[model samples]
Target: MAGPPQQAEGSGSAQASGSSTARKTFELNNDVQVADPSDSLFAYSRDEERVLEDAAPWKKDPHYFHTVKISAVALIKMVTHARSGGAYEIMGVMYGKVRDGVFWIMDAAALPVQGTETRVNAGNEAFEYMVNFQTANNEVGKDEMLRGWYHSHPGYGCWLSGIDVNTQMTNQSFNDPYLAVVIDPNRTVSAGKVEIGAFRTFPEGYEAPQTSQYQSIPMDKIEDFGVHANSYYPLKVEIYKTRLDEQLLDLLWNKYWVATLSQSLISSNRAYATSQLADLGAKLHSAPLDASAKLKKKDEGVEDDATPLNQATQDSVRINTELQNGMTAQVIKEKLFNGKLDAEGARKAVLGVL
Candidate 1:
């Protein structure tokens, strides 16, 4: 799919022709600072000239203009999910903070969904995954707020469909600063570059001034579609990089190079299965041998005949098992504090005696 439509020239002027409302500027109070232009750690640069005041003509009536900044890791995750879906469409939710008019995307989670060429539905496990995600991330002093959603267009270009517009409208109504991002995975892979679009919907009953350059849609696809496909204004996206992201990119390059040489999905899966089976077989074989040895010792009336090496091995196993149990108890306690498990459940989980 092609990416979202680019903003036209002169579209950023805050003052629309004959408009009476004044442009408003907001200052953010959070720690989400804009990276310095001279910073070498960041991979992408923001277009300082493209402010919300200069939004597309269709979005002039919105109360405030919004800018979207995606973290390097978040952008990578989104693109990875899109590429994994291949020709099928995939959907996911974005986690971030909305400071002033700026939306910073900190992370993303791919929802459980089965997608076809045109539509993707959140799968049965999606709700459970979302609940777990919220519980794990929404800690004090954390910037992991639910911000918006994203999906892929596969072979189609990145313009919003009528259904997508409706979804965006509902999201914006409930979540101010909510954004909808569309990625064209096919284009990204083929072009060896990311192809994506960020957009915000206009308010209800808002009409755009007619333009001579606008083209009419064919009758079959236009029914009930209204101006939805054209109503959204594109938001400039900046993928800000961090030091950790640079390290991850270096590791990824090595992994991708290795993958290119001998990696096929089927072969990798088969190897994993074979390794697991071998481990299971080893455990199964050793268990019977140990039992038979114990039976023989009982028959010979040899009690407590462990050698020094065997005693040490037994001690090591017991210590390791106790350490695992302690870690499991700690995890249960944290889950209780996070309200993922009730007190009674936590008690049972941590102390079997309860």
Candidate 2:
């Protein structure tokens, strides 16, 4: 029976001098053997070692990073999921591959997790689903990897809180080159723009890099996020698009434009009221008849003396009504053009109003 395997020459010294305290303190149990001295049990030729090294290159230093690319479909899915959550926060896992030092996100899976205004928690079900998804997709040559995760902030805006930082650190420890994405659906809608961020956390005790290479996100959105911003670096995102995606975007653009062009009933009413008040003021100021004469006539029991004011008020109301009708006609035309309303439906709408 062989005793404990002997360490290679200078191997113990190298281990002692290494900067990683965890690695320096690690002890192999009785079952393991050092491969250098073994012939049949474990062996590697010099050339074979070189080939293995070439096959699996060493990972870059923890501070270094690569760009992240997301597919348009994946982004659309994330945004749709965030929007569906409404006031509550939502989270999901991202699946993709890392190639040529870039993280390319190709797909996403929504997780059925408990969420609140500030936090999200994934249970055992989420892990099971993730494993099943990875297995199923990998079998079909998808080769999907659990690259990162995304969450929504709802009304708060897109930024990582302290809890988010801790979560990201754990993920990074489990999987190097991990990413964190945050989306603010409410802020997106309110600002009429997408509020999203991609970040890579620094290794423990290392300072995060700060450079303008990343995409420009609004500072206002992240002003109050947390103090951990200095511990992570924001990454620029590129949405990959295909021909099919372009066509879909075109259709969506038309629909959105039509909806935006349609005036709301409340706004139309407000505009009409404002215009009527302005016209009434102009008429009252321009009248040449003296106020004293009108009062004297009123005292003399002239019943029809106030008829002009009433006529002016009636005219203002009629003009405002016509303006509102014209606005409605324009909206109908827009809806028909965008296919939201068919030609027959638009015609019916106009005729019914008439």
Q: For model 2, how does the per-residue alpha-carbon lDDT over 157-227 read when each residue is reduced to its tens digit? A: 46677788888989887765578999987555544457788877776787655432222222233334436
Model 2 residue 263 CA deviation in Å: 8.4
| Local accuracy by lDDT, each model | 0.60, 0.63
**Whose lDDT is greatest here?**
2
How does residue 79 of candidate 2 score in lDDT?
92
Encode model 1's per-residue lDDT on 151-190: one tens digit a residue. 9977545667788888888878776557899988755543
Candidate 1 differs from the real structure by a C-alpha RMSD in angstroms, to one decimal, of 27.6
Cα deviation of 99, candidate 2, in Å: 2.4
**How many clashes does the backbone of model 1 have?**
6
